[model samples]
Target chain A: MKILKQLKMTCKDTSPLISESMDGHISFGKRLRLKIHLTICKACQCYKNQLEIIKNLAKKIGSEDFSSKKNQTLRPEVKEKIKQSLNNI
Target chain B: MNDRQLDSSMWVDRYGDIMYRYTLLRVKNVDFAEEIVQNTFLAAIQAQANYAGRSAEKSWLFGILKHKIMDHFRSQKRFQSFNQSDSDDSSVDDYDDSGHWKIFPKDWGLDPEKAAENTELAHRLEECMSGLSEKFRQIFIMKEMDGIDSTQICNEFDIKPTNLWVILHRARNQLKLCLEAHWFQNKTSE
Candidate 1:
């Protein structure tokens, strides 16, 4: 019955499994079900691939290499205020 | 006073700009980001006793900064935002009643094996990320960008494992649709 349930999973059910698989491990049964669904479903496959792309770019965005070069930092006045406050302590 | 100011100013001189940029990237508000960094420095100074030998001062400062960032997310008004998202599966429309994609995602044509670095794509992705609600954005970045494990995140946020996955899924679905519409179909990257 459980195997039947896994086999009957729709894109709705399987999509989360697809996403969860990336975040961490899903059960072997769920992974098997996802594989079957993905093999048959082009959209689900696309969703999986696109997530990988998004993940790749997101890592760069979070890392210094992508963000630090934008030339943004603390304002001089703000720095002075922080320093003054720190000196008061 | 001179010794303490020297210590404080030295921290500001070295880590202030970097911490500001890091916070700004996540929070996307200059004032709020600066406030968070300022709090981080202040906290680090207070926590200096516990900090010794635990780690490098720079990492200790950044660690405190990360806590401050999470604290901002965990503030009083965050309950409303979290509750709203919990009640609504905003990506429900992305699929139909029968559980199929209402609009099939466009072929991004990226190689699944290799992630080619494209600043333009990164810039576009960052823009799309900002469109997400703050809670979703931070969790997504933590899991995907910061390499934090799902269990740790679940414990940290006090969310059910299911809720965490759902949040991540919604974020991915939304970001995908957004990038497809704004970047792929916009003819800039095409």
Candidate 2:
């Protein structure tokens, strides 16, 4: 019973660790504790899965080129002038 | 133009559009993004001699562009205040004193592969991101999108690691709630 108590973590204690774990910053002991807690706690597991989805989605959104939607670009004249400056340097 | 100069010109030709896209997403301002990209090229030109040929030219240019973006954010007094004011509203309160969620997370029904192919979802996500407070949006983008290290982000923002984690936690929670309402739940109801 004492051994089980040592591994127990409430969702409040473990939720922030979910974010920290994603960033690869959590300590190994806390990670193990979180993992053990996650195995038993379905709610935190759902939270962990959802955060992973959000992170992956954010990364995709970040890498995407929205130029086609907005049609924003450096004008040719600006590009030409920058190149000219580069040449003069 | 000499070979080195020609190389520099080609760098702009190759990286200008990519950098413009990246900066535009972060700043969400076309003119500012353009100015930053232009300045990145100028800075590259001024520091041309320092190019060690260690990293890819694209990466080196990106390093300069990232600094330029950080400078723009640092100069914005509004962003600093927004950062402070928004802390009270963080998702930290969602958890109870016992450290369990007052309201447990709802299943998101996320399909990452399908979502990746769905341009509409991508656009929706961009909208959601833009909806975030400026500082949260910037830190979230820098960490998740740009793949900047946490320690570097801490130093850049003059924030402690714990503060960074709290901000990131709130950012993720906010984004999840936003996307769940806009994308996931909307899809189900439709």
Candidate 3:
């Protein structure tokens, strides 16, 4: 049952499937296959999520605002202003 | 157990920095981060009745802050264009010859929330990213960060869909190894 064996998918085969699924490109069959693999594989699951967070954080870097004020804490005036408005509520 | 316990009093003073740190890590803009944090507070005040007070106060506030951040990202997604422009034509081999990882993924033992919170880990990610090839860096960002459609990327890069996935696999794998070496290694030692 070589066909059946291949259907099982390997960490290697499943790796690309993980990335492909993120782009909404993987087929239902492959998606199902990837899900099955992930159930048994912790590492691939870890890879799936780590890439996601990195992607989320990196999205900000790629945005136009990347060049603007970065990593600064809330200003005291803005803090004061928000506090006052909340108090008004 | 009521609205009084959920009072907005001292909210800005108490949760201000915590909210700012979380949003800044996600949005990476000081002004924007401040805006979202402010909105989060406002939203909390509006939804003040929803705080069941079963969860910790900080987490309850954090939950609202996350929703506000996601809403911002979703609205921002409309203008999300890559330099390539979209005709829409479209579009991790972390394994070895036999299709198994040469070495299994070493659990960094950090959950996504914890990993995202670690400022030092974020710096390591930036450094590891810098080490990827220019093409790897570009495609990874285009696919992962830019949220570009896979087929559209294929059309823009003039590469087959299969090749794009291969490139992503390598790029992700490389980042994994680099982070393991830089961040997790130190984490274990500590």
Candidate 4:
């Protein structure tokens, strides 16, 4: 039982998701170990919250318009010029 | 127009913004970014026969653009600005004061959902992002703002998975603390 417990903590240490503990890609044993750790660890719970915040902020930033009129103006001409230059080679 | 020029048009239409934006972020200069995009296309045209199509067409253009950015940096001796040479070795210590730390990230319990409706907080957050180091800002923009996956980002930046994770973790924590402090400071002042 003691050896099994050490093995569990070692798994948690190596796993990236032990903090935020993302789902989908983790192995069953590792996931169980992380779940056990999270049940006792307030720090890991805070880390999970932080990850959620980052993801939410990222989603908001993605919806905003980062493109400008100048960037839009350059597109067509740059495309035309690329084709023209390619054909000559 | 020549056949090569016509052939290049399809490629350009597909990848122009990607190449331009990638270059713009790396160089941080509009004219230089435009020049790099033009040169990348021109080089792609000349080397059109070499494209293997293994990667997506946009990725190919971006790969070329990356090279062009490097070449431009090399020629102008502004390579110092594009330096990620030291960034790889740098790790977050308990305290690395030489690189400013505005807020200590100790048990803030900051919740984004709570902050979501606050337009003032969003504006302040953007201001803080603008103030981050160029390396940190680019990584944050590419990974977080653009929603690129870690594997794709690793391929694009030529960094290892560990390094990529470090950048993402640090960028997230930094922004969180920054936003919390910004909001807290304003609240106290009010």
Question: Each model's interface RMSD (Å)?
Answer: 2.7, 3.1, 9.2, 7.7
Q: What fraction of correct interface contacts does each candidate retain?
A: 0.64, 0.66, 0.46, 0.26
Q: Please tell me the TM-score of chain B in candidate 3 relative to the true structure's chain B.
A: 0.51
- Put down candidate 3 lDDT per residue, B1-190, tens digits, no spaces: 3433665787888778767865675565578889999998988898888878787677788778767866766566545533332222211234568777766766656665545555556656766777876556656766765567788767656677767766776677678778778877787899
The CAPRI quality class of candidate 1 comes to medium
Which residue pairs show backbone clashes in model 3? B90-B151, B90-B152, B91-B151, B91-B152, B92-B169
Ten-residue segment with the worst summed lDDT in candidate 1 chain A? A62-71
Clashes (candidate 4): 9
> Judged by TM-score relative to the true structure, which candidate is superior, 1 or 4?
1
Regarding lDDT, does 2 or 4 come out ahead?
Answer: 2
Q: Compose the digit string of candidate 4's lDDT tens values, residues A1-89.
A: 99666645422253245322431255677677777765765555555665566566555544323332234335666667656776677
Docking class for model 3 is acceptable
How much DockQ does model 1 earn? 0.57
lDDT, candidate 2, B1-190, per-residue tens: 3322326747777878778878888888878887888888989888888987777677778889989988887777344753564545456688878777888787766564454566676667777888887788889988998788999888777878878888898898888788778877877788
Q: Give a tens-digit lDDT track for model 1, residues B1-190.
A: 3322225558888888988988888778898998998898888777776755556566667778888887776673346345545635677676789888888876777875465377787788877888988778888888887777788877667788888888998898889878888888876454
Q: List the candidate 3 regions with Cα displacement exceeding 4 Å.
A: A1-6, A63-89, B1-98
Residue B9 lDDT in model 2? 47
* Chain B TM-score for the candidates in order: 0.76, 0.76, 0.51, 0.48
TM-score, A chain, model 4: 0.54
